[model samples]
Target: MGRNTRKRSKTTGGKVMAAAAALTLGAGGLVVVNVYASAHESSGGNAVKRSSQGSSQGGTGQAAASEASTIDCPDVGNGLRQVPDQARAEVDKQLALLDTQISEAYQRLRSSTRALQQDGNFANNAIMGPLKDKRVATIDRIATAMGRAGDRPQGLESLAACTLRASGNQSDTGGNQSDTGDDQNGGQAGNGPVAADFVDITTVQPNVTAPRMSQEASRGTFATQCGVNENKLYNSDNVIVAPGVDNGAHHTHDYIGNQANDAFASNDDFAAGETSCQNQGDKSSYYWPVLRLQDGTEEFDAQQQGGGAEGNTGRILTASEVTLEYVGNPGGKVVAMPKFLRIITGDAKAFTNGTANANAAWSCTGFEDRQLTDKYPVCPEGSSLVRTSKFQSCWDGQNIDSANHRSHVAFADPATGACPGGFKAIPQLVQRLVYDVDAPSLNDNGRSSPFYAVDGFPEQMHKPITDHGDFVNVFDEQLMNEMVQCINTGRQCQ
Candidate 1:
């Protein structure tokens, strides 16, 4: 697939009334229509409006309103089982467009406060109705493209109509969150990481469990030293998911390992890219959403499309430490991963898509055993914040990529510690990121201590469940074979 250079521009603040319309004829003469409109700001100059019906401690009315106010649409990409090579590009493009539509609709919902307060049917009529129409059209294009080459997907229209669902930021009854905050607008961007999105680490019970290993388990570990993105390489392009589309990820990503990775990078480009690791033979690319401190600081991309313009504002936080280790599978002997293999662990839209594919694990440095998947941990005074991602360790032994970008890989079974039928055990990439920022002060809604959030799609609300990571294997063949041998032979090697 070919890609174009990234085109970025700063979006102005306040009410934006721009409407863009484009019509193009794709391969096989399919008509592709794209329409986008910015949301109107509140007349009172407030970016966000909090419900006044709640108390400081436990207010059901306000809490219900806050929790129930978010857009929920079925994930069309997950429903796809097979996409022909001829239609894969078009399908991926349409999928990315679906994500953009949802983000825009969510933005409209957030900005139109007065309309929502004045009219009961304003959201359904103005926001959701139009969003559904756009989605239906995009979904149809996907079906048509696939039908031309292979069998068309069924029941895609059922995924078009979205509904208002909970934002997954509701405060736990026993969690520490006080509504008596001075900052009313949800974070610095007026979108997310609300007071209810965090919990004290000390209160969470230990939940980490190890899978039972058998006698045939591969018991070695190969640790690769990739710096914590010290050079600050970042981009919003997702080559694995959206491929040729620029800004496919509505949020920025911190990149390490393969320096030549971008939307336009080809397989040949990655093979020839510069390396950040001390071992030049390993050139695999590792990236994830950049963590940010919502403290009113404007970084370089603050006003750009994937940054503040998309409700991802504040100062980008670089991980104090990043560990990339390929460990042996608990199931059996390991195999070398094919070059250019891609894997996406967690769901970036899990806040609305549900937690079926969510794999984010959060904890404090000392309390690593107690991991939190849905809520950010308020670490103690000295402990640092940690984000860990354990990638799928079982491969189909055939394709490097899949139609949904996930069907090609699977995680080993937890109970039996066995790979699925016809699948082979492979080295599991365990990524760990540590940050030294102070915990947010939920009592004051992060007024004194700013709330930190992982950058995500605007509609995802920056919820911790939406945290995810991306990896592309670009290791030299010799180095990859060595990694596989070390893991299978039970030898710890770097």
Candidate 2:
């Protein structure tokens, strides 16, 4: 199925609910609307209350009274299913520009508190109007490039207009907002990760289940020992998504496995790069956004573009343990993944794009059975925080990547554990990261104890739901065959 055809489905109030809406720009220009559904209901326990405060890092503290508001634009990248190879580069550049535009507009919204309070129409008149004009021109360039190479994408102009949306923190809040006196939200930039973003793991019921294995199941697993990013390799460039764009991710990523990965790294660079894995033949690149503690300390990227300057501040916390394992499909034997196969498991913009592509799984060490997708888990004293990502296990067996960077691979069926027709099952990379950090004290909005959040785009508000991971397969032919053989024979190999 196409990426745009999929809808986010969640089980709430004992019934599965799927809500989706889209906006089209008319002759009048931009139409302001809320495109996402309400926040997921807390399974149990009383709702947490939140308050707005100025960010110590110079945020203007101008969110709406009830919830933090941000600019929401239709994701143009998600709708582009096809772009000719000749136009791919230009399309990617345009997509990156689109992201940059959104980030810039969001920054304006966050900084204009006085204007927002003084003039009710300030956001629509100043921010949204200019943003739509820029987007229309950028999108036109993309369409022209694609038309010159292949077919022009239709209905792209409809995506140019943007609107203001309250970040999905409505249902999660209850009682009265608390004033912590200290002027800071969980995030140093005051953009997000408020008290409502976290929930005690113990209060959440067990929600994970195992898929049934068939007789043809390839039950073996292959584990790669890539150290926990001990070398401290980090960057904001995304080679797979925006190959030639700097700060394409708008957030720093902690890299392991492959040593030579950045926005400028080509396929050849990845092939010739050094490996951090114990097995020299396995040079795959694995990276995820760095998690940061919202303490007052400034890190190396404090003054950098994709770091503190972009609202991703705080001390970067290296994962205590990083486990990269490839497991087989439950329905049948798995095939070797193609070289340079790029897979992004979660959605970094799930906060605005909705959860159709969200795959973040958070839990405590002992409470692994209870995974929290929307809320950050507050682990007890002895327990460590965990972030788990299970990558797409089925490949289309043709392209190494797609225009949207997601169409080439797909997750197995939730119930049947089978690959879609015409696609082959591949060994799925299951990454588990363990972090040792103190739980944030939610009552005072993490004032006494700082909140820890995964790095994301500034406008994404450091939402836990936006947590994502990326991987590029660079295993040598020998190691790749060995892994496939080990899996088919039902033997665990490393």
Candidate 3:
């Protein structure tokens, strides 16, 4: 479900603060996980699940920024703003590394799981625990890097690019996007007041009117649909998503942290999955219902298709907009996000398969592509541009070749594709972006990466289910070689 765009935590926005709180077990990790779990269960049994497929986002400028990425910026009227080309490049580099490391850890986990199975160590959990430790360490490294890099924390900036169209980008109707061409520079190129209000909170809103806890702002269709906005959700706030949630945790003005939020994020409890797997002799929590729909031919619904039809919550991942409370109230401006997309579950064959070449569970679903793609300028079909399978794969398990692409990114069907026999499928929500700006022409990619997703726990790297630092480490090492060669030749930034 992680594309260029991701949740700051789990909420769709420009800030990339996503970490599943799975790494290194930060100080507050347990509290958050418990809370998130409660929220998941509370979401109820019947909410219409939708496609996690996201629509096209805004454009990244023809050229990348130089060093402007490190510059400190503030929260706009809400939390959305333009990122310098330098910042985008750095973030992309960081994401690349985190992606790689996590994949590596996952690979190790695979090996450990197998080792455990063969050595009769599953019951002892010795292999699993050690592998989990390694994974957590890797996640910690990613979190540390995020803190060091100082971008929209988490690997979320990419999600924002996917969600919030920078300025000057266009959106399909009802898709919440704009193309005004005005940016931080106050008029594009991020030339204006770059520093905006920034929000950093660890708990749900104590009170709506309590300073950062609450403020006043306009709410529209996008806000109602996505469940957050400049007034509530932020261009840079961390949201949480858990496997199970409890309704008892719901609180007043608690929209941001309560378990009740499960309704909006398209998460469906696996009651059926629990029942089915209960008799299979597998782990109790491993049951997944959406996967049951994999065999149903209703997988491909161009409009309102094959997601689990639970509650009547009808929201599209195609596009949406929400304004967070920008303390300065900078002219009461709103941030526009395009194409919100996310998966209900990350467990898939792609994870089971070490590299991309291994038989994927549903590489055709863009699921693997979403997890393994490199930089942009995808294939002719757009999505393929990020694929690496066109090259070759290696079994060394140490070095990962870029060309080892996922499936046919060029011909993916709608989120509604019927699963082939024996394939596992999960629910996903998709939506487009739309913008309601003060001026019609003021709502496009002001200056940022549409392919970037903002992390929810910008400060807490543990928020992302998968470590984002893995992406950065790999990217830096890869590009650094090129950079070192350029530096030796007296080249600054190519």
TM-score of each: 0.84, 0.86, 0.20
Candidate 2 — worst ten consecutive residues by lDDT sum? 8-17
Indicate which candidate wins on lDDT.
2
What is candidate 1's CA lDDT for residue 86? 74
Per-residue lDDT value at 303 in model 2? 87
| Model 3: CA > 4 A from native | 1-37, 40-91, 111-114, 117-292, 296-494
Model 2 residue 305 distance off true place after TM-score fit, in angstroms = 1.4
Which is better, 2 or 3, measured by lDDT?
2
Tell me the spans in candidate 1 whose CA falls farther than 4 Å from its real position: 1-67, 168-185, 444-447
Cα RMSD (Å) between model 3 and the true structure? 27.5
Give the distance in Å from residue 249's predicted Cα in candidate 3 to where it truly belongs: 31
Show where candidate 2 strays beyond 4 Å: 1-68, 168-186, 444-447
Residue 238 lDDT in candidate 1: 88
Model 1: number of backbone collisions? 0
lDDT of each: 0.75, 0.77, 0.20
lDDT of 2 by residue, 434-460 (tens): 999997866642334777888999888
* Global Cα RMSD, each model: 10.9, 8.9, 27.5
lDDT of 3 by residue, 6-90 (tens): 2221121122342321111112111011111211232122122111221122111111111011111111111112223223323
